[model samples]
Target: MASDHVAEFEAHRPRLFAVGYRLLGSAAEAEDLVQETFLRWNDADRDVVRTPAAWLTKVLTNLCLNRLASARSRREDYVGIWLPEPVMTDDSALGPLETAERRESVSLAMLVLMEKLTPVERAVFVLREAFGYRHREIAEILDITESNSQQVLRRAQAHLRERPRFDASGDQRRRIAELFLDAARGGDLPALERLLADDVVSSADGGGVAGAARNAIRGASRVARYFAGLLDVPLPGLELRVVELNGQPGILAVVGDALVSVTVVEVGDERVRRIYNVVNPDKLRFLAAQCGLVARNWRQVIEDTSGSVMELRAARFRE
Candidate 1:
């Protein structure tokens, strides 16, 4: 019975980790929290529990709260800017809509905005918005009153209201990304400049764990210059291969068949608003296994989805 229950728990680990990662904004910490939750579940009397997933979520949320408390303290002493660990997963499993939803939720800009909320506020907001948990479920998870959960959610939503949301379809984004990639690969700075937002910003996360820009690159012209400058730096053997990252157009830097880095470009209102270059080896561990990367043609996928899983596939297609 115990072994069977463990198998059941393992099956849901991805969803739980996804929840934790959104709340905490750190993939490594999310995995740790999920692992700890399972350990607690394994040690507990399962016969006494009614909803195992709920129990695990509550346990994981509490652990994340504690971890966030400590993380804040440690971040204060951190040498430079702190970035959330990037998540690398197989994009083939997602339809275009699923990809877009996941990308929007995990975007670096979104993660940065999430940092504004207090840990409890973050937990409440994620539970209410991301997982669609009821106020009572969230209250139970946080050990707070239902009224408090509602209030926290209101504040979180208010804070998030300031950030603009993208409206382009998944097919549109993929097409736009392809054009941008073509311009960049062809060294057509003029075309690339046209696709970028006037005030675009770029950020790279090497975590100081590797070679990366320690700070964010701001302004559209500056970002264009940065990309243009890249062509000058002789990577002589490096090839820019475009792939679907987090459900958006991403470029992988391949050097003699080795995948070095993955970059995700954020598009807003038909303009490239931001670029997130993730070069951290640790964050790219999942991709490290694939010598030659592969992904579903999200644009094609979006256009052809008139089939059975339409609703389940909608969120992914609208990038």
Candidate 2:
């Protein structure tokens, strides 16, 4: 019976892993957390655990909480702007839950904001809001008083509610994404200027190993001027390809034989709100396998973003 129960528990692994990934924002760490949860089950005296799922969740959440606490220093030292690991999936494979996760999961703004939350706070809120876990169930999983769980969730929600909701259904977003790609890759300054809002913000993450702009670029004119200078750099075989990132259209630059960088455009109505360039090799691990690479090298120059501006170079891994 115990063996049977354990097998049954394995069936929920994907859902649990997704939960952990959503909270922790790292696929590798999420896998570790789920494995640890099951390990506890294997070692436990079954007579004590009345609810197996609850027990698993409790173990997992606590383990993640500890990991998150210890992870602060490493994240602080992370190069440039840190972006979420991009999950590559064809649109057809999306189930309702997966769709929801992709929509909410990869939002750069949302992910950054989540960093402000304590691990327990994130756990409580995700359990309650995303998984429909009641406060009582959440309390059991978190090993906190039900009221405490409720309080924590409330505080977490309050912090997250301030960001403007992203609407993914608009055609303007897709159209603008295409326009931005044309402008950015073709070196059409006028086309790029027309697409960008007057007050646009651009940020890049190059892991500091590469010469990326140390600060965020604000205002449309500055970004335009910067990109104009960038396009002049000699990247002979590089081309822009459109793909969906964070549930929206994005552009990736394939340089020579490697996919070097990804550009995510956040659109507001018909205007471009934000441009995020991910040059940090550490953040692109999720795409490593897809790029047919064996190991990721953070220092190699895969794409040159700093043409004449500040001499920034971006790299991605190739097998």
Candidate of highest TM-score: 1
Query: What is the TM-score of each predicted model, taking all chains together?
Result: 0.82, 0.80
Q: Which candidate tops lDDT? A: 1
RMSD to native for every prediction? Answer: 11.5, 5.3
- The 0-to-1 C-alpha lDDT of every candidate, in the order given, reads 0.71, 0.69
Candidate 1, TM-score vs. the true structure? 0.82
Query: Candidate 1 on 16-47: residue-level lDDT in tens?
Result: 88788887877667878889988898898867
lDDT for 262 (candidate 2): 71
Error of 1 at 40 (Å): 1.0
Model 2, 1-319: lDDT tens digits are: 8779778778768677767776787767877889888887788887998877777777888888888898777789886676565544344211133544446545565666788888888888767765779998888777789899889988998888755355645366778888887686678878888888898888877777555676889887788777765555555566677776656667766655566677788787577878777766556655545556322322354234324322432321111
Collision pairs in model 2 = 293-319, 302-315
